[model samples]
Target chain A: MSEITLGARRPVIVRRRRWRIPGAAIPYLFLAPATLWYAAFLVYPMLQSLYVSFFDWDGLSPSMTFVGLENYINIFAVDDVARLALWNNILWTLGALVLPTLFGLLLALALNRRAPASTLFRTIFYSPAVLPLVAVGLIWAWMYNPHFGVVNVTLKAVGLRSWANGWLSDYTMALPATFVTFIWSHVGFPMIFYLAGLQAISKEYYEAATIDGANAFQRFRHVTMPGLAETHVIVLSLAVINGFKVFDLVYTMTYGGPGRSTQVLGTWMYFQTFQYYHAGYGSALAWVIAAIVLVIAIPYIRRMSRG
Target chain B: MMSDVRRQRRLEQTVIFLGLLALSLIWLTPFATVVLSAIRGQGDLLARGVFSLPKKIAWGNFAEAWSTGDFSIYFRNSLLLIAMKVPLGIFIAALAAYPLAKLRFRFSGAIFIFFLAGLAVPVQVTLQPLLVMMKQLGIANSLFALVPPYVAFGLPFQIFVLRGFFRLIPSELLEAARLDGASEWTAFLRVMLPLSVPALATLCIIDVLATWNEFLIALVLISAKESRTVPVGLLQFQGEYSSQYTLLMAGILISIVPVIAIFIFLQRYFVAGLTAGAVKG
Candidate 1:
């Protein structure tokens, strides 16, 4: 009887102890480092940046005069460079949505068959995506060189010399030219993503579609497209976010050059803050970008959390 | 009719093969340009054009680039950054994730959401303020300036991965450890961590690769000559060797070889890590 009583009481004692604040300290202890880190580097700085957006100050100034969203109004109303950048970003977003996804899906479908050479081809195609943007930007820059670039040389050799122009230097051509390189590097990522999605698809779907007298194109359109909708969400959402935040590639390739024709919000933000010393204006631009990305990203993240 | 169908199918296969081959060739052009240009003599590259075959392979361009290209320092710096950042960041994230995944804590849901929000915030949004903060911290030009931010940025994803993995682990094992009179901490250290090798490995691969090729943070924070990483070094090398195609190509080759070799050797880890969330890991 005494032993039974002791055993029953033991759990209550432990539970009571565990429920106390001191006993619950372990989880908090575990969480502390990450908490401290986020508060210091991520959260605090973000809030600080938002505060700075309302001021009129160079980065080094000893004083900041509060301007009350004047910088935001200024960019929206007066800044042609920002307007141009917004336009280019829209173009980029459209291109990013269509071109890379189309090519990636096509490549993935073609390579989904178990051909012996398919693995090698997949690796080769995926190689460009693995390379540093700095290296990719430079190689394309060199390829677009005017005097003796391979692009021009090949054009001349093919008897279409008139088709060749200085690819990077021409204002109208520069962004598109940069976009071509962007696609070259980018398509492989979505290809890999789609390939993974394709492989997960059970063979029964295709077989059933075939039995229903669906041709290859019809099967692909109806079955494959809906099957990979999750991957489509992941790819398209990421593509849009990356589109808004593009910087390193453009910076390395052209530095928004030959004019500001190729400038996107990212480079323009850098130009405003670092080059022009308008830290206030730049911070406002950053806030706008953050808002746009969050508008797209939060829903996806919430959906992911639900799963 | 069956023989005709077979023949048509074979012809279609041939067409597919030719199409893939053409696309593959187009994909390889930039790599081919970089490799071929790296081997040609600089004078020949300048005079005869980039398309011209080299008189002899200038294999020594790599040697010259290593000594003069500042890549040696940059390479070491990148190596050092990853070495310090990856393991430390993963450790912190893993520790934090354990309680969130296993233990009942107040506000854990809210905390997870906060971390997830970090994913949406662009680096540019924080760039200006971060610069000033680093300056105030008096670590602006040093490698230390990068560590907190890198660790902080990497945490959300890492915690998300680890917590999900931890949740997938059968709770009975942890319960058994607790019933065996082990402390929760010991259960975590021994049972949870040992069982988490694959997830941890996936995180390491992703984190290391990101740090190795990280451009923006290194560009913004570390401007000291000795503190630069491979990407920044390559960018600067471009300015100096803008006319020297062979040398520039050599520099590019040197910078990318380590990462490409790593990817090839650990291709499965890379592909798996990159697609972890999209597919069920």
Candidate 2:
């Protein structure tokens, strides 16, 4: 009887031990599919791009020669188009940081108060966000047409006809014109974000401020802005990252047009890889862009995680 | 004292109302112009200013743009892409997120960091190699060409957001399920999934918007006219009607209606989803 009981307990213990091994491995089991997909499609290609960046492969003919950083050097040395595109990217990043943040705050403040049709006002303000970049670009392209465009027509009607050139075609106006469309398309997202953040703040803060006889601006400065620090960081980082990656609008609207005056890093990389077939050089440019985003984002990530 | 405060609040409210009214008009004008231009008769479109009230409503313009631009076919293709991509992406993301959110395993954090790295790399870097891979697979110009890459690109962010929501679930419920002899899979399905409907709905709405609006991947993958999505179709319309503002506006209007309709119907989910990711992270 004693041996029978002992044998049964031994099997149970063995079964428990066996289960522990796989139980500890369960997370990997769940993560395997996604990791596999990422490895094959993302990590593999990234490494491949880096490897190919050292070669002079034109994307097709199988004969590859080792170029040994020639592609990177050449891209940096003689690429005026790249320089212009980078400048546009910087301008975009700056504009995205400032304009959307300000507009979103203003919109949030206006809608923060209880009012009739506030929901309608919020919806109207945010409608542009739901439209795809391609659609926005196409619509705005029509609106930017020098002759029949609403912009020029409105300018003419207002007796400011000389101020209106082909908004997207003129070399000087093209980039800023495109930036305006970008701003319009994106401002709604941060507005909604800021609104949610505002609502999350306790009413007691405001009440306390009022009791202290704080003015509106003073309350905003001391209460509202401080309360929105997390939101501010998220918005700023997302805006910067998105600014760096903007391509579709530029592609559909300008196609790096009017002598490549409106080209940004994203569009430039597209042209280099797809059109020009300088896959090696394009990869180098892509790495540069990624490095820029990382430099800006890593500190924020650390700050967020710490909080 | 109370009356003065009330009056001051009323005055402030009026100021806010007027300011919002002006801002809303400025914000809405571009959309209004698109709709008006699309509805205006060709004669009215050409003669009157772009913002003028239409002399006659050209309801036929929407029909014409739909039929002439082959927008119906494009719409179907776009729907198919979204239908396939969103579910598949979400399923993979959910499966991937479950373990990361629930289980304690070695390298879980490292694996997550790998996905975090993916969020920073723009789509352009991956495009060239993806094109090469598609060609190697010999489906370079087909609808299948678009799906794999879309899912690949979408997984990281989807997993990120879903994992955040999943992590917030109480661990005690999961342990109770385990005590009740439920397998991990069963526990996830029966316990976690029902509780996660809101988060899943948010994910679905966002994925729909992103997939439906995706253009760069569609441009690179789908070359045939019939397989092109709405954005590609709209691009073609722009190319073909380079000079005809009215027809172009008509095409733009047609392209936007589906998006606007979906957004309006799912506005709550859309706002919640956007705010969820933005506010939390």
Candidate 3:
């Protein structure tokens, strides 16, 4: 165990004749396949992405110029869409934080008491959350269609014809229109969390609050809010992370725009890398996404590892 | 006084019922649009209105979308990917989970933490380099190229759940098996996996949904028409048939129906697995 003989002289190999393989190596053997996949696909590419970010390389050719910090500087100083995408991500995070959190809690509150046909109502409220984002996005896209869309059709039927603008085409409306679809599909997520959080709250707390002469709102504020604090953390953190990760919905719905007005970091990165052949700039964008996700996700990861 | 109380209760119930009904209808409008849009002719839709009842139900849209939209190939490829990917991912995860959960090793804690860090790394970050690697390896557009990335991305979550389930299993069972001359692999195969079936099933369902709907990686790594999964295939369909609204809606429904049906029937599993976050300190 001496530092001088740390490796070569201190072999602790078990010399049992009955053993074919060393006992100490079994876990590593068990770990080999998953580790290999992660190393090859996830870890290697992750480091490679960082390396590739320092260069001006179209993903196609054999030549790449090492353009030190030009790509990173371009993102911060030069790229208009990059700034817009950053603002869009912040807007998306705020929207995700507010709308889904509020509506999901409301749905959880309304259905928490298990009234008549409550299960069916729960199913209805949650169904949109379960579908593929592409399907969900297209469904909303159809509803938002300028000419024959149901939103315009419904408005026209009600004789508010002028109010029926092209919901997905208008610059101001397009981002919010896509956000509405995000809310529709995602509100159920936080609802399920709140519903579980509500169930986990001991009934005795409510009884005690009632005995203290509290009204429903007071009891909700004092008891229910504190009880669901952990759920709130889980929901808000995940919503923020998914906010950064948002691609499928925006990609499917608006493809980041009528004129890049709907661009988020994810779809912007996609277009830059694949569509425009700006691999270096796109890698920088991807790293930005990774950086944001890591900051939000570290606590969740640490908590998971403690198990 | 009793009669008054009963009247109040009945009135409250009625109000609740009506409120629920209104909410359900609002929540269900998009689905209603899809259902109606899927059943009508293009002319009928544009002529009558978006919400109009079909004068004659066109059952042909599903047939046309299935065949003409190339959705048949997409569905087959998606299902094949799911069948191939989920079991292999879970098996590898279970193997990795067993030692991380049970065996006391020098670096178990560090290794576990390293794997947890993978959870925070976005798949988008891995795409460009993985695409390059795949191209260099000459397997870029093949359906099987997705297997490695999907499995790698799935591992952190899968191992987290399976290891949580495994840790809850009494260590004495493994000790007893070892005393009976069972090797570590035997102890794992015979003692650990069978007890973790519930966790494994939940992982299966979660991975199935993820793999089916996964788009960006598949979109980036896969370019061949024959290898396109459901999500990408439908996107291509939308571009090709921008005017065929009915057919596109039909295509959307056809893609989602199976998973929706599974969700309805297995509602409990979906809730339990999805909400199994690591909030516990």
Candidate 4:
């Protein structure tokens, strides 16, 4: 019995010895490329942004003077532009969250029942989400043109001539008008998401509700709504994040135009950093935007994880 | 009572269907207008209502936009970028994800969580650094500059999604391969990849859509007119012909065709891919 135990133990000892030296190293080999790439590209750049936030560095100029938190202070004290941007960001978040979600749910509810050419309608409805933002922006800008554009022409034909104005250029209407375009471009995405979520729900739930004398509203409220919680959370979070980062559409359509009335944080940051060359101030603004998103999202993420 | 309820449901369904038809029209009208305007000559667009039928169709607008906007070059650039970036991104992501999914490494969870944190970090935050790095690498304003950052920013999400997918594969299959004298690489290549075609197809479709439609990164990175992707090229055309509404619409229509074609062709995979990324752990 002793000799047999020794014979088995000898191989076990050798295997353990082999693991100690090479097993620890092998995983690192797998990790090396990703680790290196992340450090050089992601981590280092983040630190550099932080460092650059303290100095006034015109991206090309050799002269770098540290302004400490003056950039942050100036951004808060004298910049109504930044304030407007912050407000626009809030409006964007609200508009993006409410409009898309409600419209998507409505579309999904409407399309739930079989109809003629339902699949074709569904595809057409979802097509906008696939188009590039620039294409959408350019298309809408043409439609919003003051003369000979589709929107104004339609408004005039409908005898709403008083409402016919340069929608993209008007101070009172530009942001909301632009928001409508943005909403139009993005509504397809949420619609599709909601549709998928709605489809995932078993018809049995609705059937059970029907047996229990539940009407359409009740079925939707209790069955569809609850079934769609995960989709809502994902969509809501994405909407908020994308709202906070609204750049391309604004940049393409209005250019924060007609006296910066349509400015959002992203375009503001772009204007300050790349256009105006206030790198430090723009960095500060970028950080503030990041900080706001982090504050809102981290708690939400934690809540989500717990659930 | 049951018959009455059924009648009411039928009425509600009709109302709902009509409402959806209106909404879908609202959604589709803008795109339809662009397509119509693109095929109509400038005079026809002015003479008729924006949504009215064109008296004369100018199928030449597509060819005009293609030639004048130099879209052939832009299309080629976009195609090249997508071709290179998608495979590179997927390969890197798969390689990175395999160990995270299958290997019993000590820091694998930590590493993965680190990448998960990347999901919240917007590309805007990384733009400046990426620009600087690209400039330093001497590839700024070129297609090469666009590729690396595209891969880098894309890695975390791809790896995260692919890892979730890889985890869903049965461990017994992997073990069987291992028992058959297959090394880890061989096991991953032979056993795992074949099982992952559906997931891969989904990822490929999503990647193609995203990279094809991507604007901001291209806007920041590619400065040369000749090097610009379709989106950037459209912006340039807008600048050159800001008042020429018909021409601008033509450009918009041209730029959208490739993406729409891809979406229609692979819409099932697109829907599956998006939802999987959204819902998966």
Candidate 5:
């Protein structure tokens, strides 16, 4: 008993046999609380939701009836909102990928140099990113206010009276208007990331490019874009993820309304589960979101793991 | 010819400056609008447009937003949630990160990847069952119900950042601690944590902002007014004062002041903290 061998038949020193916890187990000990917490709070809930996805139950009910893949099937076959939501998510992802990434790069390029007030300009651009999205939604809602908002007020001042409209309530303008608000809040995200990426690009690359008779555009094309490749992957991935996870702005501003025109998956899931009381269907949407995210995030995760 | 180049450079600089100024003014316009609207009373705001200056400074709008908006309670609840969740989350994440960063283990890579995978798991995926679980525990309405899920959801990022930082601490320093008869726990507490302050500080900043800004989970789980967080509280403020434009603006202003102050002071830390566990790790 004093001298013991582990499972592999390798003789191991067991100085504290009563404790039975070996050095190998020490790391596990350190990891125990976190692992337990994840298993209980994170993993178990995930599995529970997975189970709930197969059922027909209001979230508050006493008992759940197992309905197999009916909810998943219904999402495709009958749920027009689901299809519209999926389409909207793709639109949001495309919009985010284009607008913010492009504008952010331009801003980063401008502010990358150490000119006077550059930092001040940078601060101004990125400041909106720090505010809560709920606040952002509210701010822009007021900004888009039909009667007394600044958008219309300024338009009227500029003699563009015909352009002033209830942007959020208009069926065609609602989603795009919300997207403009998104651009206002989200451009800073890509700006900061690209800024960091730009800072990391070595001056040697530029020097060599200049020596090779590369003009400004040529040097940027050959050097800067290539340098920011990893950052692009990361930034674009995040933009897509943010698109899938679009909730706060949509919820607080248009609230998937003017008759669900703004209903992305996030808001749609909330409507399904909480409002419509379709717990199982909502869980299915949740899983679908997870699946889509994982598809984008796997490569990102692999990229991160190398570090 | 040299003078021409200098003059050309000066002209280019002027154009760049003007462009930047235009963008800055455009960006600042939203905030300027809010400020203008905040200081004006209801009559003043409705009488004048949002873009106009305050005719009568209703500084009491802030006080009314604070009391009537119930932002005082919201602020307290948010602070309490942060206080409880941040420390507990950081400590637990740090503990796990210590082993994953410095120790030899069979499942280290797999475990790390597993945690990293959690990063991609959207809060929506777990919201339903988490709410059900919270209800079963009978803490669904309590602020305490928030702590577990907050800490849980925060783990993957927290651990990712902390582990990346912990790995950067010289291994020789840890070896020195080991030689000096310090146990793993002692080495972690004394050597690892102290050396990881920059990482911890960044994590603290990140955690505060995230917890403060989080909306949907709080929107779903918290139905009670007293237990409401800042984001939800702001939504309530919006609903109640939808027409009371000045008061709503004041409430929005009050909610953002703390984070904006943090940003202005710690802008460097903010960027560093935000990009901490990103691909560059």
Candidate 6:
């Protein structure tokens, strides 16, 4: 407690604390880097896009004339392309939401049986989910080729040669063809989620049901379906948001063609901004898409945060 | 009664196996065709369609595609960006997550929610201004231009996972370290980080896969040919060689090999991470 001893201890403490941040400031110091990155890159840009959406500037110009709500108005009133894009977005979202969940639940049920080679089959089914969407588009585009592609080749072999079509380039068939590849890659993703949920359900529930003379279907209806309710929300919301924002697959495969028939909101926004130089209009489209995703996602996110 | 129950279970297993086997074959057919097409020569492909047996294996197509497609440049750019971005993103996220999970601070709940909300905001909504910002910073069309946004976008999920992990690391260990006169920084580096290897590794795998396969951002930001990443490069390669299906397939195979290799190596962690994100957080 003497002054000289205190002075000596103080220097040692100062030396140790030089590299050690104080406890109160520790969180802030740790947070500074990530917060700054998000602020400058994500938050700032998000607000900037919102502001730009109300204007008529062509991206690179120095002056932007405010044309409040005009871009959104045009999407409904005059822009057939926008209407087409919105319709396609809906088709993609609904199909992805329904089919993937059904197929995923099916696969999860199959795998949950603990059959032989189940792990291998799970990996096989899940493999496509990891490949880049660009690669998915390329592989499917080749498989959909009218002359030598596998789909056509298989159809011809099966005595259904008439069913074979130019899948991606045929305007009427392109969207459906694209959906096949989407569903194929996505089914395994939800399967994994459902598998996790299935694993969490206790064996006691099934045992109790079985003792009551419940059949297999009845056990599944009472036990499995209710157990996976949370996972369904996660899977369905993710599928819907991703479907609304689909771009890479469409861009790589059809480039919004055979006459823009496969165009969705995400790619159409890019076409408006980068290709046509209607940057303000694209910003408007982007906001609308983001709004749709938020409308789907926010409720689930709120529920998650609460728990 | 027991014998009947066992027999029925055996029958159910058989049915499940056969069903999964058939579906697995369907799932793998496209990949098999991609690989098969990649090694077949144009002459062979023209003579006998994509599914036909190859009489002569043309391994030379890979070499030709490697050189002619300029995939090497694109691969290097992707590797460079991933190498820079993934570790930095994980480190920043883990650092922030530590206090949020362990240390009690004001507005921590609100801060956590804010980060979670970032997950729902699609990147397209911010694309224009981000491009403008990249231009202002003089990094547009360069690998450096991609880093900031990539790191930022990756942080929300990484932090969410890490916070869950850090919270499980009993506070008793940190308290023990403090009692031994360890500073907070030293405690983090020496105690917490070493315990977090599995979580960090999971994040690394996820982020690397995401950055390597990222398409849309690279497509929008990098216009220069040399600056393009693998996905964008492959897309342009397909555009230029639309009719050359064999070589195009080679390029596709080349692009996916690394990701498949990584997945095979770390599949357990990857699966755990995916489920953890859904089930827990």
Which is the winner by lDDT between candidate 1 and candidate 6? 6
Q: Which structure among the candidates has the greatest TM-score?
A: 6
CAPRI tier of model 1: medium
What local lDDT score does residue A227 receive in model 2, on the 0 to 100 scale?
91
Chain B TM-scores per candidate, in order, are 0.92, 0.95, 0.92, 0.96, 0.95, 0.97
Lowest summed lDDT across 10 adjacent residues in model 2 chain B is found at: B272-281
Error of 3 at A127 (Å): 1.7
Give fnat, all candidates.
0.65, 0.63, 0.70, 0.48, 0.73, 0.73
Each model's lDDT comes to 0.86, 0.82, 0.88, 0.80, 0.88, 0.88
Residue-level lDDT of model 1, residues A1-307, one tens digit each, is 9975775466421432244346578898899999999889988888888999999989888899999989999878999999888888889988999999889988998899876599888888788787888888999998888876778877888999999988888998999999999999999888999999998888999999999999989998999999898889888887888889888888998899878999999889989998899999999988888888889887667744544
lDDT of 3 by residue, A1-307 (tens): 5754653363323222366668999999998888887788899998899888899999889999999999889988999999999899999999998988998998888788868898898888888887889889999999999888988888888999999988888899998999999988888889888888888898999999999999889999999999988788778878888899899989988888889999999999999999999898899999999999999987767666774
Error of 4 at B153 (Å): 1.9
Q: If you assessed candidate 5 against the hidden native complex, which CAPRI class would it receive? A: medium
Candidate 5 residue runs with Cα over 4 Å from true position:
A1-21, B1-9, B277-281
DockQ, every prediction: 0.49, 0.45, 0.48, 0.38, 0.51, 0.63
Candidate 2 CAPRI grade? acceptable
Can you write out model 6's per-residue Cα lDDT over B17-109, one digit (the tens) per residue? 888888889999999999889988988997788778887998988998889999999999999998999999999998888888888888888
lDDT per residue for candidate 2 within A85-185, as digits (tens), equals 88889899999999988999888988877787988988988888888789899888878878778888988899997898977888988888998998888
Off by over 4 Å in 1: A1-25, B1-7
- The segments of candidate 4 whose C-alpha lies over 4 angstroms from its true place after superposition are A1-21, A25-28, A299-307
- Per-residue alpha-carbon lDDT of candidate 6 for residues A59-93, written as tens digits (9 for 90 to 100): 99899999999999988788898999999999999
Tens-place lDDT per residue, model 4, A208-280, is 9999999878998999999988888878877887889888889988999878999998889888888888877
B1-281, model 1: which lDDT tens digit per residue?
99998899788877888999999998888887888789988778878877778889999999988888888899888888899999999999999999999999899888888888787778888888888989999999888888888999999889888888899999999999788766777678778998999999989988877888778877888788888889998999888878888899999999989878987787777776676667543
> In model 2, where do residues sit more than 4 Å from their true spots?
A1-21, A300-307
Candidate 5 local accuracy as lDDT?
0.88
